[model samples]
Target: MVSDKNSEYKFTGGNSLTGIHKLYHEVMMLNELWNGYGAYEVSYAAGKSGISFGGNQMDMHDNKKTAEKFTNILISATDNAGKHFFTQGEVKMIVGNEFVNLIQNGEVVLSMLGDNLASINAALSSVYGRARIDQLYVSEIKNGAEHIEKVIEKITNAAAKKFYDSDLGRVLLFDYHNQYDLKFDGRFLADYINGKGKENFSTKEMVVAPRDHSKYRAIC
Candidate 1:
């Protein structure tokens, strides 16, 4: 009977030890699983954030490119026509008695007068012959200036609307806080879209304001 009690105690203690070992092994397995899942979650979140940010940048870049292209097209068309009309009648005159005399013995005179105000008036009359020069000049000053102003206004309005309607604009106006160190309130984008934005900011005031005119004059 004593031997039986001792055997029972040994068996019970051994079973308890086995149970503790099994519990520890289960806990270790669960911890490994949780850590693996956590690593995967972290990687996925990082990838998703990167993709979102990159997409926004690319979209903004494309919007700016399109705006620039449209601006260039309008500017090129108007500038080219203005330049041609202004320089079309340029001419030069040469005076000499004979070819050999002009070359060695005689003097020659060269004159260029097509770019004078009188020549320009004549050319303008020829192109717009139905109207008087004075009348045309007045029309150009009033009606022509108004037309060009309207064109510029249209281009600027369209560009501002397009930029503000874009996803990047929403993010910049709402999500990002520091845009080039300017404290942009949420309404800046809206105001610019509505043609009420401020126009007093200078792009080169710091670098050009106090410099010598001869040293910092624009080349073009």
Candidate 2:
């Protein structure tokens, strides 16, 4: 049986990760376009959060995961200067302040535009002043892109991973997981598959539009 690259994905159980892994790269390409490529990209206007850093726009508001994300990146830094910055524990304190600012003021505002490298440097200067780190964040967080890939891998693993068996399926599953964390309805999926009487489902057919979904949604 041949796999349909557009619709169906059949994983060959071997030393090949081409099918699912390639599809992950394809999805990440979209993220790169929207959230900036690599981990060094910073989003200044992150809605209510005020400042978002990293490739995937990890917000600098009361976001615990985002804080942890940066912390791990700093801890994993290869350079002595980068690794030394994390040990000082400034990122945690600054991120904690960001959370407090959000709670008290409803916004964690920053003067940084984060449009380019120069702007990011200025922002880091301001953040370093606040954290009293002597401006190490810029150099340290640049390592974020390298670690962000690992973060995406973890996200992919967390997303509804078992339902579909193709690249298309993984993409759809990741999108669905983004919307509804781990609320995968396996029973409904089995029912839908049985009702359709089809062994393989297409991305087009499998994806559930918000309006077209029932209470027991397969990819909710």
Candidate 3:
């Protein structure tokens, strides 16, 4: 239930996305800008991830978390054809943890026999070839909304069914999705709104991340 109401807020870089896409895509663009990265470039910065790869700045580190993210995205992107190089049966043992380790150090080069896990090399050249792009980028913003909805509903109540129906509300949820702390009940959004004295949200500026958490910093 998105809002039909309009506001004077303008999107940065000016994308053609509308409705939910508009807010979600705009947030991605802002993420790139914040990290000083282009859509295709890879960086060695360590914020959330040791290696930020691709447009969405995905974590390419050698760990369980990264393995899971790549696995899910690979399967979702193409009927599991791309990820089989690491996820296939029995042979998964070879590429499972070692693959991430090889990635963290430098280039990966391997050739195995009778193993369902495909060959891996520097460029990931394999018998299966390259992955086909279903979209410009892979993202899970919609999925994160599942957790965010619970927080919004519990903390903000009427705001979820009402204020959250607007573009601003959607964008706020997207922003919070990145910085959300699991230990908290997602009251950060509600506290942010209250800190700004917004009984009823009135401006796009209110939707931006606060320069300082101010009074709400302690709550988080």
- How many clashing residue pairs appear in each of the predictions shown? 0, 2, 1
Best by TM-score: 3
Per TM-score, what order, best first?
Answer: 3, 2, 1
Task: Judge candidate 1 at residue 155 and give its lDDT.
Answer: 30
Give me the runs in candidate 3 sitting further than 4 Å from their true place. Answer: 1-18, 33-37, 60-65, 68-139, 157-165, 179-220
Tens-place lDDT per residue, model 3, 5-124, is: 111222122243455765666676666434322332223443333433333444455555544543433333322344443444433453355455324522221222223222322112
Stretches > 4 Å off in candidate 1:
1-110, 114-131, 155-220
**By lDDT, is 1 or 2 better?**
2
Strongest candidate by lDDT: 3
lDDT agreement with native, every candidate: 0.24, 0.35, 0.39
Alpha carbon lDDT of residue 211, candidate 1?
A: 23
User: Could you give candidate 2's per-residue lDDT for residues 108-198 as a string of tens digits?
Assistant: 3443212333423233223232232212223222333233333334332213222333345556645433222323233223223223222
Q: Which ten residues in a row have the lowest lDDT in candidate 2?
A: 1-10
Clashing pairs in 2: 9-166, 39-145
Q: TM-score of the candidate numbered 1?
A: 0.16
Name the weakest run of 10 consecutive residues (lDDT summed) in model 1: 51-60
Off by over 4 Å in 2: 1-17, 32-38, 48-62, 72-93, 97-165, 179-182, 185-220
When 1 and 3 are scored with TM-score, the better candidate is 3
Candidate 1 C-alpha lDDT tens digits along 21-107: 333223322322232121101001121121000101111112333223212222222222354323211221111122111122111
